[model samples]
Target chain A: GIQVEQSPPDLILQEGANSTLRCNFSDSVNNLQWFHQNPWGQLINLFYIPSGTKQNGRLSATTVATERYSLLYISSSQTTDSGVYFCAVDRTLYGNNRLAFGKGNQVVVIP
Target chain B: EPEVTQTPSHQVTQMGQEVILRCVPISNHLYFYWYRQILGQKVEFLVSFYNNEISEKSEIFDDQFSVERPDGSNFTLKIRSTKLEDSAMYFCASSEDGNTEAFFGQGTRLTVV
Candidate 1:
């Protein structure tokens, strides 16, 4: 099983601020995803980057598989971005694709 | 886009009672999974189902827990006897295959008292 750790457990930023969140994994993974759990508890898939970089609107993510680390960047943040961001990984050991999630980075974007 | 859908957004049950949480994954997806998140805790994997069989499961998914794809479109998780500790948000997710991204349902909040 792989271990996932998210950094900056708690973050508070004003609207329009820019911030970065990080995720570190213990082993090589074939599937990695970034999710946002909104206030209502809906888990929204933000990205499915196992390697390289991807940008979606104000959110972007980069995963360096060889380094076993990933970063999520938020630019010009808005109040709607306030929630918990989680990074989950599925190792290639059994090819089952069972995801192990990090504790999450709780972000509070104040207006 | 097609998304996973879960029934009974919230449920309240007594300890020692049997409870079943249901989900409908994306029509074209082949892999389905169940994950739980306790209050203020990280999401944890419970089990993964594919080809009508379990591919893998976590320790938390012990004898008390079971999963079934009772129909072509429905996937379900059943807890034989609910415990106070079992109270959490249960999420159902699905992926097209082992290499693709998983899409999660809105989740069902289970409260055991």
Candidate 2:
């Protein structure tokens, strides 16, 4: 099983501020995704980047598979962005595709 | 976009009672999974189902827990006897395949007293 660790467990940012969250994994993964659990508890899919970089609106993510680390970047943050951001990964061992999630980075974007 | 849908957004059950959480995964998806998140804790995987059977399960999923795709479209998790610790937000997710991104439902909040 792979271990996922998210950094900056707690973050408070002013609206319009820019911030970055990181995720590190212990082993190689076949699948990686970034999710935002909003205040309403809806798990919104952000990105599924196993490698390279992807940008969606003011949000972007980069995963360096070789380095076993991924980063989620938020720019010009808004109050709506306040919630927990989780990074989950599925390792390739034994063809097991179940995801293991990180502790999550709790972000509070103050309006 | 198609998404996983869970029934009974919130449920309250007495300890020792059996509770079943239902979910309807995306129609085209082949892999389904159940995950739980205790308040103030990280999300943890419970089980994954494919081909009408469980592919993998975590230690958290013991004899008391079971999963079934009773119908072609419905996936359900059954807790034989609920406990106080069984209270959590249960999320149902589905993916097209093993190497794809999984989409999660809004989640069902289960509280066992």
Candidate 3:
């Protein structure tokens, strides 16, 4: 099993601010992703970056598979972005892509 | 953009009762999974299904828990006998390929009394 730890378990930022949330895994992984769990308990896919960098609107993510780490960046954050961000990894080939998830970074974008 | 759909937005049952949580993954998806998150807690993987059998499962997925794809569009998780600890928001997700990205449904909140 792979262990995952997220930094700054909780974060509070203004609507227009920028922030970076990090995810550190215990070992190499075949796949990685960032997800936002909204107030309605919906897990929205934000990024699927096993390695390299990708950006989408105000959200971006970077993963260094070799180093076993990933980062999610939010710029000019909005109130709607407030939710728990989770970084998950696929460490093995079995189980329909069984992913080990991090505890998550709880973000609050205050208006 | 394809999205997974789940039924019974919320469900409540007694500790010793049985409950089935249903999900319909994207029509073209081949892999399906179920994860649970206790209120204010981290999301935990329960099991994954592929090729009509379980590909993998976590320790939490015990004898009391089972998953099935009884029809073409539905994947279900049935708790043979619910327990208080089973109360949580259960999320169903699917991916076109096991190596690609996954899309999750809104989730079914299960409350066991």
**Highest lDDT model number:** 1
Where does the lowest 10-residue lDDT sum fall in candidate 3 chain A? A91-100
| Per-residue lDDT of model 3, residues B66-109, tens digit only | 99999999999999999999999999999888878888899999
Q: Model 2 Cα displacement at B95 (Å)?
A: 0.7
| lDDT measured at residue A103 in model 3 versus the true structure, 0 to 100 | 89
Q: Which pairs of residues collide in candidate 1?
A: none
Q: What TM-score do all the candidates reach, one by one?
A: 0.98, 0.97, 0.97
Deviation in angstroms for B86 in model 3?
0.7
As for TM-score, the candidate ahead, 1 or 3, is: 1
TM-score of chain A of 3: 0.96
Q: How many Å off is the CA of B24 in candidate 3? A: 0.4
Once fitted onto the true fold, the runs of candidate 3 whose alpha carbons sit more than 4 angstroms away are A93-95
- In the range A1-111, model 3's lDDT, one tens digit per residue, is 789999889999999999999999999888899999888888899999999999999999999888889999999999999999999988765446888889899999999
Q: Write the per-residue lDDT of candidate 1 for residues B1-113, one digit (tens) a residue.
A: 89999988999999999999999999999999999999999999999999999998999999999999999999999999999999999999998886688999999999999
For every model in order, what is the iRMS?
Answer: 1.6, 1.8, 1.7
- True-structure lDDT of candidate 2: 0.94
Two-chain DockQ for model 1: 0.73
- Alpha-carbon shift of residue B77 in model 1 (angstroms): 0.6
Task: Give the C-alpha miss distance for residue A27 in model 2, angstroms.
Answer: 1.0
